[model samples]
Target: MLQLCRDASGAPLAPQGSVVCIGAFDGVHLGHRALLARARERAAALGARTAALSFEPIPREFFARGTPVPRIDDARGKIVQLAAAGADLLLLLRFDAALAAMSPEAFVEQVLVARLGAREVWIGADFRFGHARRGDPVLLRELGARLGFGVEVFPEFLVDGERVRSSGIRAHLAAGDFDAAARLLGRPFMIGGHVVRGQQLGRKLGYPTANFRLGRRTSPVDGIFAVRVHGIGPVPHAAVASLGVRPTVNGTEPLLEAHLFDFDGDLYGRRLDVEFVAKLRDEEKFSDLDAMVRQIDLDAAQARSLLGVPEARPAGACA
Candidate 1:
């Protein structure tokens, strides 16, 4: 079972001599994977379990109020990814004021030394923790030496000569460069949600769609996209997707809708995972329904071509 440690509350659990990596791991990008790999390698060598420690409602979210932040994945998704990466234990530490107020020494002594029994610690060069972000790689090394633990700080991971980072991935997604973002993420960017009812606007336009209510924290890629829908059959199907507040329809809440290339079925309440492939265009308003239909036709053609769906029908065709 996965263990989630929240705040320095109650009695500390006895350490099992684990090799751990610590980070926000927002996107679980290549950098995160590299750190995890190192941790896993060290754990195997030392005969210790591999674990990842991260915070929930990330520090930035706590500081940002309710403003929409560019999050590649939510806490649940982070845990899933970490577990898939061979984490024997996953700790979802609740980032409250009390935990945030711990001094560097206290954090290392209480969390790392006492609770986690960290035999080996791995992190990126830029990793920081403790009160006021005073804990750097050097500080961790110094503390490790005193605490009788090993510390490994890895150099930044690079892709195409550019350092792969969560911020860089967010920037690429914001600009609708899903392909570039995927290259850094080591897989296509995917958003999973349960299908929900919509205003039937797509149906009226001759293109029925599966509407999805994204999680509270999702990336800020608000635009039309070429996507692939998974969880329906042997292979994912090509799709055209829209993400954002529907300005033309005067919609308030953000919505994610995907129209499959050649699929016809009721998908209400079904879980859908949409893999973003390419950005077709930015969302725009049309003067009339006819104009909107025409633009959607063009968007569908572009999405199909980008997704390599050879038999994709035109926009107005029935699925």
Candidate 2:
């Protein structure tokens, strides 16, 4: 079982002892998994639970609220990935003004020591935390000596001579490079959200759709693509998805519109994981509704041909 905590003031998760790993873990990529695996190994050796401490809004998002800073994954997606990556408990500390005001020492004493009761702390080589980003591996070791917790910092993770990072993944997605993005993410980049009501435009055009609102200003990727819809049934359903502001409809917020291939049922309000397989084309506006519908038909055919039914599985699955 995975225990989830949102409040630092809540009951202690690991009263006995815990091996703690902390990071934004935005995509819970291969680099992040390596660190979590080490925590799992240490926890097994020490007879302790593995706990991951991460911040909501990822600090960067909170700090750059009005700016168009897209995320590799959403909160719910991050939670699922963390548990799959071997975290027994997920401590999603809410990043608010109060937490932002807390100093490094206070954060260690109150959150790590009191709430989590951490026995071992693992972090990435360049991980930074606490108010004004004053916390570091050296500081953690100093606190560990006094608090009886051990600290381990991993070196920068690299792949193909480039550091594996959320930013790198975002860049690849923006460039419509699914292969490169998959390499960095360790899996297909996906948008996970509940199906929502749409304008029925696709239905009117003979292409029924499942719409998902991202609740974010921008997306890491914005285009029409061949995709797989997961968490909808026992098997992944093939689909064609458009991620953009629906220029033809004069839509504002970026939305994910998935048109499942030869499958239908009520999906509204049901959570679905839309996994990116291949970029078909960039989102574009048509001269009219008929033209738009024609384009969609062509897109569907291309997607079906590209996906070829049995999509090759990525190294990891979206948990």
Candidate 3:
């Protein structure tokens, strides 16, 4: 099992010593994975465990206040990816006012030294932490010298000579270039969550869907997508997904509604991962229910063709 801690101060987690990697790690993109892999290598060399330190609500999100900064992944997604990336222990700090005010020295002493007993700490070239973003590699080295830890800087990760960055991935997603985004992510961009009950309007429209609410998350992609729904069966199910506020219905919150072709099993509470394959169209307001349904028919047909789904199940079969 992967051990997780949220508080900044607590009993020592790795008394035997650990190699720690720290970052916001919003997307766990290719660059972030490189840093984690370096930590694993260092941990193995020193006979220590691997630990990853990150922040929830990511510092930028906390500082952004009411402004929603687009994120490639959410908290649950982060946890899942971090573990898969070889983090034996996860320190997901709550980034509140108290933590924001902590000094770089204090963070190293309390979190890295006292809590994790870190023998070596790995960080990306542009990493920053502590109050006012004062923490840097130089400051970290100074603290490490006095705190009995060593600091290593992971080189900037690149693919095809292009640097991998969260911002670049976001830009690709915004532009609906999913292929470019996936190159940086090292996998197809996806969103996973438990199905939630919506207004059931899709069912009334002859398209039953499994809904996932975005809550406070600001997603980079918003539109009709050709997607593959995972966790439904042995193979992914080809589907058409809508991610946005339903303008026609006057809905406000961002919701992901996936209508799986030929699927009729109950999915109200099942966890599903919707993998975006291609953007079909942007969300638009229609004049009435009839018009909206017509547009939806077109969108679904386009998605089915793009995903190479031989043919959609019988009409109203999913309903």
What is the lDDT for 43 in model 3? 94
TM-score of 3: 0.96
Report the error of model 3 at residue 283, Å. Answer: 0.7
Minimal lDDT window, size 10, model 2: 310-319
lDDT of 1 at 193: 81
Query: What local distance difference test score does each model get?
Result: 0.84, 0.88, 0.91
Winner on lDDT between 1 and 3 is: 3
Model 2 steric clash pairs: none
Q: What is the C-alpha RMSD of each candidate to the true structure, in Å?
A: 2.9, 6.0, 2.4
Measured against the true structure, the TM-scores of the candidates, in listed sequence, are 0.91, 0.90, 0.96
Best by lDDT: 3
Model 1 over residues 15-81: C-alpha lDDT tens digits? 5588988888897888888888888888888878788888888888876788767789877678878
**Superposed model 1: Cα runs more than 4 Å off:** 1-7, 10-14, 310-319
lDDT per residue for candidate 2 within 163-204, as digits (tens), equals 998888888888889889899788988888889999998898
Ten-residue stretch with the least lDDT total in model 3? 310-319
